[model samples]
Target: MKTPLTLLGLVLLTAASCSHESLTRPAPPPGDSAERGRELARRLIIVDGHIDVPYRLQEKLSPEGEPTEDISQRTAGGDFDYPRAVEGGLDVPFMSIYIPAELQKTAGASKALADSLIDMVEKLARTSPDKFALARSVDEARRNTSEGKVSFAMGIENGSALEDSVANVAHFQKRGVRYITLTHSADNLLGDSSYAEGAHRWNGLSPLGKQVVAEMNRVGIMVDVSHLSDATIRQVLETSQQPVIASHSSCRHFTPGFERNLSDELIRAIAAKGGVVMISFGSGFLLQAAQDHEKRLREEAMAFIQQQGLTRESPEVRTFIENWLREHPFPRARVEDVADHIDHVVKLVGIDHVGLGSDFDGVGPTLPVGLEDVSRYPNLFRVLLERGYGEAELEKLASGNVFRVWRQVEATARP
Candidate 1:
């Protein structure tokens, strides 16, 4: 048996070998061309690690909770819709089944909500069979792509949904959950979250959290480290047998002191583990200025709530919030900013360790200008092309890297 140090050495060696392979690989048949980039986007299997469509849909629906929004068509408001996804050449998108941190306190609420979200995804595919298909594996994604359908992959955005039971991991896997984010806005039984203030229950991961990681590996579920604290991310990198993912994280080097984004060292560590850091497109994640502005807004909002002795649930407070948001709009990040994170990852690691994980619906209207919706993926591809990315490199950025990790995780799982 290899010692932890020996295992880490092997992991680093594997990552270096993969990195070398990507660099030495032959170029595409054609040169780096915009037209070729567009063509390749249409042909390649692009997979986004996180898109909170179900939660967004729930928000957009009527109070009665009926299916008011038809995402199967070209929807007007949100970032993702079927027609837009097809236009953007997005073949596979992991629908983030996000469970809020507060739900962690309840015994079975998170699990129930997760189940409902999965049911919602299944319903979307069932109702839009011509346009959508549920993809449980890379092969299924390929099959659905060949059939001219957009493949939907599910990722549980909070490990709290597992309810401290490792058995629930397999249960969720059976329901098509491909990955699990260790924590959300707050610390859970699993681990500490970057967003949780003064909450460092588990400096990294709790005892059960370690067991959950192993169970996930054994069940072929990718461990997502997004929203985890630096300590938790490092712990996950050390514990997981297969490569894990930062489902929707950005380079913290860009937004210094922002714990939600992965620091340069953590990014390098993840790459050493042979995992890909999927760059998030949220403006807060992309730009320091945006991050600062968001922090100010939250502070002001909290102050206002206290000054007026208003509760968040109060109608007056809601109105105040609405008016305040209207008064101070967030600065818009550009497509170039999103590309910058990708470039940072490439420079720090390599193209083999970077991919897309746009927090589309999850980011509200804070997305960059050109990448406001699913249809804008081609704009990113064009930017990459202009930045000297060839078809091979672009393909790796698009989905090849993530597919490689997914396949490796699947291979390591108990059959």
Candidate 2:
């Protein structure tokens, strides 16, 4: 059988070539508005709803099982680190415990991986108490910020980690996990995935998924709608008593047909229910040109691999991908495009329903130009400021909106 061209495989193939040129730090923003934007970024409590730091570290484990890169200090690769997050004024970054969809095929494998990743996060906080702290609630995260530490709030990217057990929802909640994306690249027992091909398994959410949603609400976990099919999202909205969040999705209005992003109707629905849609910073998530470019590159690269009779994992295929990427350099989106997405959401449903959720370290090299990594958040703020956003509105976009939703989720839970 031909090797399945997995999303993770594609990301690895293009990561090196897709990355922007190295920068010690982003240059200081120019003009009065830029300066004010930078100041506001430092002053506000910025909460990025989704970041893939834990999984990124897990991917770089040494043979001895230790992490190769030290996030406590600046490292060569990846998007997040202590220094960069501090510079960006990022207070709370929800570390994604990303469980691969294929792991669901095995009985306990998914839950096992989730437990291991959770252990890894706990270890990070335990070892670096001064630099990092675990935040299980909005109040705790705010306290961590006051203490000058970056708060690591956890969110499971795929619900396969629940392993067909409704009981696992409460189990993860007790482990500092604040949100759970019900499905990933493939359909699970809970629901259908936006990216899953063929007919949907559950059509919307299975009976087990509805129970999971209810359990999550009762246990103080935010139900994440990102990566789920439209049917699943609607069902979740209906079933969830507390506000839900799309932890890292952009507006689908920009990248049409990209079901991975939220539609205008869906955005309004999420907003009507008092939830927030955290706009993602990936280039493909921001622009139609960038999305088209990515799709074309994948198709061409796959055709070349098959024509050359090379395995996807072969060195020859890797070299071909690098060359192809270099030759057809991806159409990069700018920081302005990111602001446009935020603006689109605000226009459709007001600012209360939108926040930032940069899929850092997860989107490979497909990040936007001015918003390349954790240290570049002020660049986005500068653009928003230029477009006439006041400090109060900017603060709402920064963390206030998501925190409100989170607090409501917490309050809705039964003791």
Candidate 3:
């Protein structure tokens, strides 16, 4: 075996020998293939269909002027910060206007969240029009691309923002909100959530939920069925007058334990309706091991809060718990496993109906290791290529297909 010094001497000798005229070697095989992918990803309109930046901004700009509680700066630390987004090659991200599901049944739920989240996106676009602009159409998304600006679009995670009224769906569309998830954690006026604690049951969409779907289509808002019960998914697929979108969901085929994923039946229904299912990178929605591990961790976290007599409603208690979870975190899925979901969606619903939708801040610190944050998106591209996705298909998955769907839906909108 060569000693360290001897190895260094040999390497130096090789360098000296290379000065001879006959030194010839085919241009060292091109660098990381991800460069090509990354360049394309950067130049093209890359989008994560959902993120929770408003939660951070709202937490920061609260009227009380930053919490007086266990107030750490990171309470305002979100995964998709502006500088990090540029570094990650993300050109467009549907900033999620997520209203807690429980609030919808209350008095001012719809108007409050709708006004609040929409304002957040508007403010971000206003403060940095050089960096981002609110895109109401896919054409605008591409136009923003030419201007070197990120497209900031909106997706309502829970239809509770519609406030159980047929008119509010269009209200959001006027605010530049594009899609609406018909249900969330608990059943809203729209339908039941896949994760809501209950036995296997089915009521599909209520009369109002069906009206919401029709109204969403008429207003050009893509009907998003992410958190909906399977029955509700079927209803939206059948009722939607335009292409539907599962804004941030994965294939149940890839991650068996997660109820949040779309089944083969649901996948086919969505694609059959000319819709797209942007695959989610959340560990809970991707791999079985990652999901089970995360579920156990959440249970343990809940127990810890209980033992400590902490309450979510208490600012101090919530802050401590949030920081605690951020520090401890959850078991991570691998980048390759995250790509495995992309592969599953492609196989299940063709390359024309898949895109990336990493639930960055919304997943509660349960992202994969290589995908620890939005900055690691290049790793996902690299892993996808390694898994055999060609450039053409990868382009469709990154954002092209989503753009196409948006265009078709926008062009066909009655609004």
Candidate 4:
């Protein structure tokens, strides 16, 4: 193993390597990769159901996509930039208004976090009206499409944002938050987080938690099962009269031991109920090997970070972390692997239950390499085309399935 080098040193080396590659004239896309990808992206109404953009706002992340004058820029250095989204043919991105779980436990914290998220949404809308129009409903998404604008749907990443109040659910519903994950990295008032045991007062969606699910269904909010416990997931599925989505989860078949993944049985359950499972793009969440590698890298990086005592989320640190990730580069969890997950769900519950929810900015440095950022989605389209996925199947996998479930869930929620 190589001894750890300074970030400055790594940057110098990578700069040289990049120059060398440019000098060598990198290989062109053989036959039809780029063309097919272009065609595929053009046709599909891509929807990324879970992105951490609102989190980026809180963290003060900048837009990274090129064409500075263009309207569609995404977070700088982070994935899902504007030029790239247009290039990838992504039309609708359900921007996550995520509040960390800790906020729910502390009184007033949820409101504070919610206020920040709302503020960010307003800021985005105010600053980039041409690029992003809020998709308050499926009708609004369609309206945005007709107007040739990007649909910006809002979703609360954790039910903890409801903060033990039934009315808070209504508050978020009014704020255009279309979905809510039951919990996050830590268990909150709702239930146990897949990451941390959040059962401080009550674990796994207390009686209030159950009501939140029903309320979400009643209020036209989609129940997002991305971070819920398996029990919580089952409960949500049982509780919601409409189909629920595992908004940004991968298959346990692809990445085992990550409870964040929906099991084969759970996948079947979601599909049986006519719900969709948007595949996640985080390497750590996709392949155990990749995640394990990054885990060690993080430990090493953190060890270095702690030793140096640098600010964790600073630009210098972020640049350093991004460069570090560029090293252990997780291969495109192969579009085939993505298809395999889609196939797994398709076989289990048919085709109407699969969609793409690449956790672009949310996954941070652990995203799929070729699929890095929103712009790289063209690569997935190319891969899918290469895998012999036809147009009809592609449509369902791209956004049709998710849209279908969304319509149903929305219909059931209407007054």
lDDT of 2 at 132: 97
Task: Rank candidates by TM-score, best first.
Answer: 2, 1, 3, 4
lDDT of 1 by residue, 1-415 (tens): 0001111111100000001101222333456455665677788889998998988876566778656889998776778899899888999999989887667777999999999889999999999999999999989998999999999999998898999798999999999999999888778999997877665898999899999999999999999999899999889888998899988898887778988899989989999999999988877777777656655655666677689897655566556655766777656777878888888888889899999999888766677888888888888887777676777888899899999999998888994
Best of the two (2, 3) by TM-score: 2
Q: Give the number of the best model, judged by lDDT.
A: 2
**lDDT, model 1, position 148:** 97
Question: What clash count goes with each model?
Answer: 0, 0, 0, 13
RMSD in Å for candidate 3, one decimal?
12.5
Give the alpha carbon lDDT tens digit for every residue of 356-410 in model 2: 9998988877787788899989998887877777778889999999999999999
Clash total of candidate 3: 0
Candidate structures ordered by lDDT, highest first: 2, 1, 3, 4
Q: How many collisions between residues are there in candidate 2?
A: 0
Global fold similarity of model 1 (TM-score): 0.90
CA lDDT, candidate 4, residue 218: 88
Task: TM-score each candidate.
Answer: 0.90, 0.92, 0.83, 0.81
Q: Write the per-residue lDDT of candidate 3 for residues 1-415, one digit (tens) a residue.
A: 0001111111100000001111122232345757755765675568788887765555566576432222112234558766667767887888888777557658776668678878867876887778889988888887987888878888887887877689887788899988887777777777777766655334788889888888877778888888888888887777877788888888887566556788988888888888888887766566665555445545655566578786544455445545655665455567776676666667666888888888877765566777877677888877666555667777788888888788888888885
Runs of candidate 4 exceeding 4 Å displacement: 1-33, 61-76, 197-203, 294-332
Candidate 1 lowest-lDDT run of ten: 12-21
